[model samples]
Target chain A: MIHKRITKRKIIDKLVFFLSSLSVIIAMIPLAGVLIFVASKGLSAINLEFLISLPKPPDEIGGGIGNAIQGTLILIGLASMIGIPIGVLAGIYLAEYGDNRFGSLVRFMADVLSGVPSIIMGLFVYVAVVLTTRSFSALSGGIALGIIMIPIITRTTEESVKLVPNSIREASMALGIRRWKTILFIVLSTAKSGIITGIMLSIARIAGETAPLLFTAFGSDVWATGLNKPISALPLIIYRYAISPYANWQAQAWGAAFILVSFVLLLNIGVRYISRERYKK
Target chain B: MPHSFFLFRKIKLKKIKRILSGDFIFKNITLIFALFVLSLAILVFYELYSRSQLSINKFGLGFLFGREWDPVQGIFGALPFIYGTVTSSIIALMIAVPISLGIAIYLSELAPGYLRSPLSFMVELLAAVPSVVYGLWGLFVMVPWIRDYLQPFLESILGFLPFFQGPKFGIGMLAGGIILAIMIIPTISAVSREVMLAVPNAQREAAFAIGATRWEMIRVSVFKYAKTGIIGAILLGLGRALGETMAVIMVIGNRPNISLSLFEPAYTMSGVIASEYVEATQELYLSALIEIGLLLFIITLLMNIFARLLVWRMMKIFRGAKE
Candidate 1:
């Protein structure tokens, strides 16, 4: 008998296996390349002066994205206020009372909404808010981000709420409590951690968004005040600087990118750890 | 009898009851909140339709097929952009699906447990790396590499084909497609891996009990079992590549012309709108851009619905099996 039969099928199987393994190795290259390059280049740009001071003129040497950092925070904060309530409430509706046609429609819309190119959301906000306001505002940027957040948060909330077993809800309902009370007090509390994770994920998503805020925020040269005037954001600044002819601005762009990437990556890692621990429970 | 009596009393009391009853108020409000999702789409459509009326009226149905996009002549058409969007997304899908499926297979069925979780996490990290960062990398690292080596190499080998006939500009449809494929790999792979994992272990055992090799077992049991889910995952990836803005905009060279050649500069629907919308001061031009946005919105929405239908079908199958 043959000690090792080298049949045609065996050779083909080995080849296919090798190719699959090779493909996964190739896919890992991009993640490693992007992370290493961004971190190394951006690390030098992060200093006390860069973080705390206002931007210098394009021709100048040292500047910070302080205004942009503040603007991004304000924009995110405002967007959260607008988006989280609507998203969480709609999610609650889907979880608690969404056994009908409207629920399915909302679910469908949520999927479609997430698929909308972020730039379109920007345009919608630009037309709906900026045109009415007669100027670009943080309000418009918030509106754009808030719109983007709705679908993500809605889907996450629904999934998490669904995870709370029916028996738990039944127990709550069997008590002398109203349906809404049972949902709000019992089911929602059980799902709070998951819902929060969803919110964090949404924030991480919109935080790096540049296309949606391009026209909505319209960029600012100086420290802008309030939500009326145009505001600079971390992503908008990165885009602007990355395209500029000046080297210093480009450096600043790298620094800002480092910050943005670190923030997003850390948030994602944190959420994953939390979710994994919860999974073990 | 008591329940019926209470229901009758409640029905009678409803006319005199305050409208602000907690149950009624909360349910109707949340329902209204749910309806906002539908209204968001409708409002976007209405806004786009009303805003783009001038362009819609001027170009009629010809706008979709007309090729010229010269804002200087006040003429606008979306065909090239549509071509670029469709072709680039197709390229992304073609490149990404196989590799992602491979990764899914490796991660789920082949990789040992010690290696699997970290590898999966790393892939997920790529998804969180942000599009702008991807765009930046594509511009600084990939485009130059493509221009210098990849395109020239491909052109030399495949020059006889029309698709490789363009001049070697690194930032073009090919570059855009590659970047998109990278960005989408994590998503498609993760979803496909989940689908593969959901395939029962008995199938693997049964396949092994036969004379099935590793690849053969996966192909017959895991892959065939999760085929619909994998399709849904690929479609979702396709939808994502279609709507991706900043990364594609950066790498696609933003030329408003269509050609069969992947090496030439081209524009996508989202790419065009992103770069041009803010500067499009002309009435027809702005309206035309908005109209393009409307078109993109419709396309992606449809794509998503189709993908979701596949996923829903998969869920039904799972439930049916469980029962």
Candidate 2:
């Protein structure tokens, strides 16, 4: 009876392990399926015309989202300007002077900010900025995106700053250099690749975000000329076109999705390459 | 002698100011940025509450429990959305936990070193895919697949139950749950894997020495030690599922209903806010939507704070173990 029980226990353990392995396979289906399906459907729609012209009417066979691409770049630039300075500076504070209770509070707030859904941030911006401005604009969207970017960039900056060895600081201090100068010139330069990687990741995240842009930027079909005007974006075009019934619009949505995914993926890999080369040393 | 002494004192004052200025300026600037993050949180809550006060005053405490949600007649209640968000997140939790645990185990214990990082990156990629893309996929591929096959299969297996009695509408609570599961699996699995990795090697070796099987070692020793971290990961995942908007809105059929049937169409708190906030014409309707945003903000804030506490404690434990 004892022998039988032990053997049975072993068998049960084996079964559980097999089940765990099976679940991993099941988890991969959506991950791989979404990418593959989007690629296959979106590839045929991509051409030069798809890259450099205005969106066509629903029935038109082919049109491009050139304006949306330019708008996306401009919006990204606007978001970077708002997010990076405060985020990096706050990160420096965390790394350098954040051993106190105030540091922990900021850390907690950063996590909370990350958890706030992207759409709600848009609504927050709508209440705070859009209402005052009396209209949707690229400025509102960028502000919303900038808020989302802050905690992410801040955390990454903190981690990378922390990773720089304490010996560097000690060495600088021994040379009679001031603390702030050492941090700003030596430590930050040493961690530049990592910091840039963090920024790149932040950009990639906001680039694909659609919910925050829905009401804030309030998509336009034409090129957005000024900061106060509504801007077209790649994700918005994909969303609007995908929801439409027209075949051409749907095709363009696919094409745009392809481009968007490709852009984010290439950016991730390229940034990783730059960072990893430094990490290897 | 008096004039020379006064000039010397002025020179000393200027030199002190110059010496302290650079370092002091940098610290204060960064400190201001850090303070801004704290104020940002307070400002969000303040704005949400201040903006939603009109609805709060009109509805009193009844806004939460009231069922009617009519824009035409200026009636608003958040009950359906609350019910929908909680139930869908529960469904997602049920579906995601097992799969996430599995992936975590595979990463931490089963996978060979050669295949580990690549597989981990692939799982994280699921997170990187935009939520809208997931919505599109759910609408075009997953929903139809469910309507034609998965729903029918579930109905046949459990049709006697009330929860399974509804017709397959393709996009509803179950679909929302599935999409949420897909989105949240990465956060849970990634964190859980880190937790598992932080499990000490001595525990594993000791279990082996006692003649425990591989699974037995993982279950009785490794996982037991890392329980808090795993729970933290699940809570973080729950927090995410609750706040998810776009995919839920796209595939949840946008109906306001409280039903036991997962196949029935429903609306979520965030979903309703996302779908209707822009089109709201009445001031009351707009305020009501802001109230929902406030509730979402409060709920997510509480959950995240609790989750972060658990994670923070787990990190302490790991640090102690390492030392």
Candidate 3:
């Protein structure tokens, strides 16, 4: 007997689901609050000069973020130099040559490493690199960030390479290609797009990292020159500016936030674009 | 000439076999390299152990139970930091978990298809925002809001409870916990949403075929199947919360006090390390910090292992059952 039943359980269920979804929406408050506040106050200052000027003193009401922009680019470049090749190679080994116990172990380790907190990695770098050097520097920060990037790239590379079909590998082998040559010439070419997405995501992950850079790179308010000295980056600059007593500094902090957010969002979009391109072909 | 050609053919076959064996060797070498990734864990543990040995020897196990940290006279205890870490993380999870679960359920079972992806992506974007940014927002906005409104309101009502006592600083454990909750919500929501989405539609349909309503069907089918996955997600968020540094340090008002009051200033393992790892001068002081690092590492490591096992076991069970 099928009855049209509006049961108590049904009412409770709907209520619970509604509450849950509403709370999720509620959780967005802090982020939305921050973004709107920053945009209104920070948007007006996002001029060419703000982008170009080095941080002036607290009294200097308007200044640009030239040093910060330059430092971030250099750090990203150094991090990629250290991280991408090693991660790609490691991933290649796992995907192509990894059919054994060691491969499984490596894959597991990479996952575990990926789960490790970025702060711990920074601490590790500090103890191993920074303390020994006896000073904070961008190289140290880049290395710390690179440590965080490696596992991300490795896992993405492995997964991307694994996605390439065995048929392709077999075809290369049938042509009498050596195994390594088959992997390099055929497998990597197929997996390059996904690998690029992984790299971009890794870049995004490191770009927002503040903890690792805190003790390692050590922020500079002034323009930075070499690897040995402390450098100004957007995140560090934001932290400094946000915490200061001055109102103008606080406004500048919001501008820096806009810059950092834009970079991360662009990286996210870039990954999406690369992945779409791969699928289209 | 025929005999010589046969000999050459034999050599060629042997060479091919050797090349195949070399390929096998190369494969094994890759596996070895993968295994080397674990060596990082080993390396971290070893470095922390040796570096922290002095503190361990000096304080013995009592250091963990000890309640004071006096850097001047070399007397140190980690009880307060330990307490701060556990309490704040627990508080953050308590606040974040329910809200995150609600979000996951809403996105998976309630939201329209077009809205799900964008909505979920927006939530994950919160995770993408740097901790330092959160720190800035918390210090400038949240802290002030708490001091101005939330703390006063909470204190008047919960005044009997010590956790709400003392004048509001806008930068104490309560504010820290609230900030941490904001940070962890996206993590839990993201993972739990994936798990909830992984639940089979067939099971939901089966429940509905028995005249179950939408909510009842989800309760009977999806939630049951995804229980372990949800748990793992929560654990992962907990692990992240435990090791969070920059943001927590910025607003946690780092004083090593073991007050029951949530408004009191406190220091976490990570917060302490980030704040002081730079100027750690004395050997014992440095080792003390490393010991704290080691402790935090161990806690997070165990949490991660638990998360991995839960995920692995659930996946294995589900896949095997499907097969």
Candidate 4:
């Protein structure tokens, strides 16, 4: 009886392992499918003209997302200006002095903020900035994306800063450095790569966000004149084109998607590389 | 001697001034930024609440239960959107939870060490794929596959069920659910893996000491130990599915109706807001969309808080065990 039970148990173990492996495979199918479809469809549409020229009308055969790419770059620049300082400072406060009720509350709120849908952030910016300005602009879109970036950056920054050894701070203070100087110069520098990794990951995240830019950027077809004017973005164009009935527009959507995905994936890989370098040290 | 004493007193005062300008200023600057982070959530809530007051006053609590969504008549109700969001999310959770748990188990326990990082990286890459990209793929690839193969297959096996009885339009609750399941698997599995890893090795060793098989050891020890955390992870995934917008909008057929069939078209709260917020000409229409946004915001906030608390508590328990 005991021998029979052992054999049965072993068989069950093998079956369970097989199922677990199958689940991993199942999870991978969609990823592979999305990547394969985007790559194949997008690669054909991509060229120098596609990258540098303005979009053509839907009935027109070929066009580029040059304006959208430029707008996306400008928005990223604007978002980073707003997000990085606030996120890093808040993270510093949490890591250095946030051992109390208030710190816990901030941390919890940051996590909650991160979980809030990107669309809602768009609405908030609509009410706060876009409505106030009376125009849809790249600035409003940048602010929306910046809000989305903050909590992500804060959490990652806090985690990375916490990874810095306490002994470094002690040594800095031992050398007669001021407390603020010790943290700003010594601790932050020590955690620099990790923090950059976090920043890059957050940048990658905002790069792919579409929902927030829908109304705020409002998506112009022409080149954006200024931060105050309407702007186009890669993901926004992809969304607008994908939903339109025109086959050509849909094709352009795939092309834009290819660029967006490649940018995000590259940023993620760069983050991994930075962190790996940190680990090696 | 008096001159030297005065000079020493001046030096001390300057030192005090330097401290005030440096550490004190630096700490306060960071504290202000932290305060901003904390207040952002409250500000979001306030904004949503204040912006949606027109609908709140007009529809009151009945907005949640009423079904009509006529933009011309301006008789907006949130029930269908709420239903679609809840149902799609439930379906996603149903599909995602098992696969996620399995992936978590494999990654945390079963996979060979050499294979683990690459597999994890692939899963992370799945997440890194943007929502729009997912929508594009869902519309072009997955929706066609559903129309051609999966929905018909489901109908053949489970045609008697209400969910399986309808015509397969390919862009409906089922597609939304499946797409959402794919999107959330990485989140659920990653968290579940962390929770499982937090389970002490001693539990597994104890299970094996009783002559249990590897699967038996895991089932008895790790699952039981990490049960709350895994549930928390599933809830987090549910929260994500509930608020997902662009992907769901692309393939969920974007219709406003309450139906039991998974093959019928539906609209989610986020989806409606995304599609209508731009075109809402009427004040009440805009307010109604904002109200839906408010509801989505509040529901997701509550779900996240509850889930995070559970995960936090579970992690705390393991830390206590270690100590």
Per-residue alpha-carbon lDDT of model 1 for B124-168, expressed as tens digits? 888888898888878878899999999889988988999988788
Give the higher-lDDT candidate: 2 or 3: 2
lDDT of 4: 0.92
lDDT (C-alpha) at residue A171 in model 3: 93
- lDDT values of the candidates? 0.88, 0.88, 0.84, 0.92
lDDT per residue, candidate 3, B1-323, as tens digits?
99999999999999888867756666555555555565888887887788899999999999899898888889888999999999899999999999999999989988889988778878977887788878888888889898999999998898988778986888889888988899999989988888777777788889989988778887899889989988999998999899888788878899999888888889998888877776779999989988998898988988988887776677667776666
Q: Which CAPRI category fits model 3?
A: medium
Interface RMSD, prediction 1: 1.4
Ten-residue segment with the worst summed lDDT in candidate 3 chain B? B27-36
- Model 4 docking category: high
For candidate 3, the TM-score of chain A alone versus the native chain A is 0.92
lDDT of 4 at A135: 91
User: Which regions of candidate 1 are displaced past 4 Å?
Assistant: A1-7, B1-11, B14-20
Instruction: Looking at model 2 chain B, report the run of 10 residues with the lowest lDDT sum.
Output: B18-27
Winning model by lDDT: 4
lDDT rank, highest first? Answer: 4, 2, 1, 3
lDDT of candidate 2 over A139-238, digit per residue (tens): 9999989998898888888888988999999999999998899999998998888888889998888999988898799888787789999999988888
Backbone clashes in model 4, listed as residue pairs:
none
What digit string (tens of lDDT, one per residue) describes model 4 on residues A67-119? 99999999999999999999999999999999899999999889878888899
- Candidate 1 Cα RMSD (Å): 2.9
